[model samples]
Structure formats: C-alpha cells, structure tokens
Target: MDSVSEAQFELDQLRHQARKQLLGTVVLGVMAGLLAFVGQSALGQARPLLESSFGTWQSLYTVVLWALAIAWLVALIQQALHYQNISEQFESRRRLDAVYAERAAKAQAVEEERQRQRAESEARQAAERNRRLNKNSHSTKFDFWQE
Candidate 1:
C-alpha cells in the first residue's frame, strides 16, 4: 500500500523478532543457572570423595564437573551477547518508528492544507457566480421599476 503502511508492517515484524530474542535470552539464562547449580552440587559431593580415597572415578567426576562449569560460563556469555544484540535492535526499531510517525504526520498536514485550498477556491467561484447573476437580473427590462 503506502509508505506508512509498509513501515508499520515492518515495525510490527521487528517487534515480534525482538520478543523472540528476549525469550531466547531468558531461556539461556535459565540454562546457565541450572548448569551452575549442578556444578555446585557436584563440587560439594566431590569434597567428601576427595577426603576419602583418591580413585579414578573421583578424577573422572572432577573432570565432568569442570566441563559443566565451562558450559555454564559459555551460556552466560551467550546470554549477555544476545541481550546486547536485542538492545541494539530495539534502538534501531525505535528510530525507524519515530521517522515513520513524523512522515505520516507531515503527509496528513499536507493533505489537510490541500483540502483547505480546494474549499476556498470553490467558495470564491460560487461567490463570483452569484454576483454575476445579481448584476444581470438588476439590468433586465422585465423589472418594471428599472423601466
């Protein structure tokens, strides 16, 4: 349709994308928290095992815990970066929305001014026509007073 309609549609799409990104960020944060809790529990359990006998199973358990911690850290970093990206997208959308709003307002103002000018021109034409009719009728011979 028009530019304003297109801009509004695009803005709506951006809003939807922003919402999905926010949801993804939240999911990542939750995953990171879960991983952290699991890692903490593993570490707490490992303390007792370490105090007892230092076995192969204990070594493998520690390695697994380290991997979980690493995964948690990666998830946290990803969430932070995703959040930053979302913020930038929202800012860009906001600017674009403002521009579209201004453009729509300007277009509306221009249309109103054009309509006002048209009305004024029609009024002037009608007034001129009425004046001509009045002048001709007054000069007509059919008017007994004039004769």
Candidate 2:
C-alpha cells in the first residue's frame, strides 16, 4: 500500500528476474558446447558423405561451430542485459527511499513549528486576559477577604 513497500517489492522482483536469466544463460551455454562436441564427432564419422555433399567435413563442422558460438554469445548478452536491469532497479529504489524520507522529515518539522506557534499564541492570550481581570478587580475593590 505504501510507496516504500511498493518500491521494495519491485526491486526484489527485478533481482529474481535477473537471477533467472543468468541461470538460463549458463544452461544454454553448456548445452551449446555439448552440441558442438557431438556435431564434430558426427562430422568425422560422416567425413566422406559431408565432403561429397558440401565439399568438406571440415567446412561443415566449422560452419556449425560458428553458428553455435553465435547462439552462445547471444545468450551471454541476454544475461548481461538482465544484470543491468537489476542494477537499474536497485538504484531507482534507493532514490525513491531517500526522497520519501526527506519529504517525511520536512513535513514533521513543519508540523512541529506550527504546533509551537499555536501554543505560544495561546499562552500570550491567557496572560493578557489575566491582566485585564486583575485591573477590573482592583477598580471594583473585589476580593477584600471579607467574611
């Protein structure tokens, strides 16, 4: 409900998202590497066929390896971008907290000042009323301590 809590929740969400993305990148990278290894061996076994079909097994293997390398790089970039997102969210939350705290503090100070002024005014009025009453009483010769 509060701004502070909302910001914290958003920050936590971003952190979780970034972690998931990073984990996905690692898994994908490992998978790509494994595929490359298997592909190279298969290419070796089918050397004659590959050469006859596309000129050379080495060519086929190289092309496949390059493709896999590209995929891996893409995944790595995604992971880095996710990390950046998390950092940006964290910084944003920090700024929000600081701004909110400042506003609350200023409001409290203003309220206290207002209360102090009101109390002082009330005290001054009470004293003025007492002076007026005393003057009237003396003129009337009131409170002679008579029975």
Candidate 3:
C-alpha cells in the first residue's frame, strides 16, 4: 500500500478504538444512572424537580446531588483518557498488521518468480535431450539378421 493509504488506515484504527471505548462507557454509565433513578443506593438519582421542593434536609440532599454530578464529570474525563490510551495501542497493532501483510505479499511474489524460471529451464533441458536422441537414431538404423 502507498503511504497515503497506510496513514488513512492508521487514522481509522485510532478513531475506531476511541469510539468503541467511549460508547462502552456511556452505555455503562447510563445503565447505572437508570438503576439509581429507581432508588437503588448505588444508583441513586437526583430528584427530578428539586425547585421549591419542601422537605427536611432538602438542602443537604441537593448538595449531595450536585457533588454526584461533579463526580460523574470526573469519571467521564478519566474514561476519555483511558480510551485515548486504548486508541494508541490499537493504532500500533494496525501498523504492525500492515507491515506483516506487506512482507507476506513480497515473499509470495518471489516464490512465484522462482517457480516460473524453474519451469522455463526444465522445458529447455527436455527439448535439448529430444534433439540429441533424434540426431543419433537417424544415422544408425540399417541392421538386418541373416540365417
């Protein structure tokens, strides 16, 4: 492959890895959030309508909810960094795969060339042997038996 194609392939590999990782994180986070919305302790969600909501310790719960939002943001950033790392690894793998393919193709071409030359040489040698045999027989075939 040319340099341009190689570069494009590498770029694609990186993007694909990053996208996949991000997608996985988003799915998990949303699922967890859903669990919390249903009052699951680990999955507790912020009350949808906190505005003017009257209850004891309401301010405390609101603060806790905001803190959770901040934590989620941090988690997202961390996941992004992790996915970037994964992308780098995937890009390296793609490059290695390309190199291996190139080497294999070159080896196959060399073998084919060798096979072609060998066939041509064998054809030439057989033709020469037939020519010599015919030449000898043409001058030595006049013997008859007498009783």
| Model 2 TM-score, 2 decimals | 0.70
List the candidates' TM-scores in order. Answer: 0.60, 0.70, 0.54
lDDT of every model, 2 decimals: 0.72, 0.82, 0.70
Candidate with best TM-score? 2
**Model 2, 68-109: lDDT tens per residue?**
788779878878887888888788888888898899999999
Q: List where candidate 2 sits over 4 angstroms from the true fold.
A: 3-8, 38-58, 138-147
What is candidate 1's TM-score against the reference?
A: 0.60
| Candidate rank order under lDDT | 2, 1, 3
> Tell me, what's the RMSD of every candidate?
5.3, 4.0, 9.0
> Judged by lDDT, which candidate is best?
2
Pick by TM-score: 1 or 2, better one: 2
Clashes of each: 0, 0, 2
The reply for model 3, stretches above 4 Å from the true place, is: 1-63, 140-147
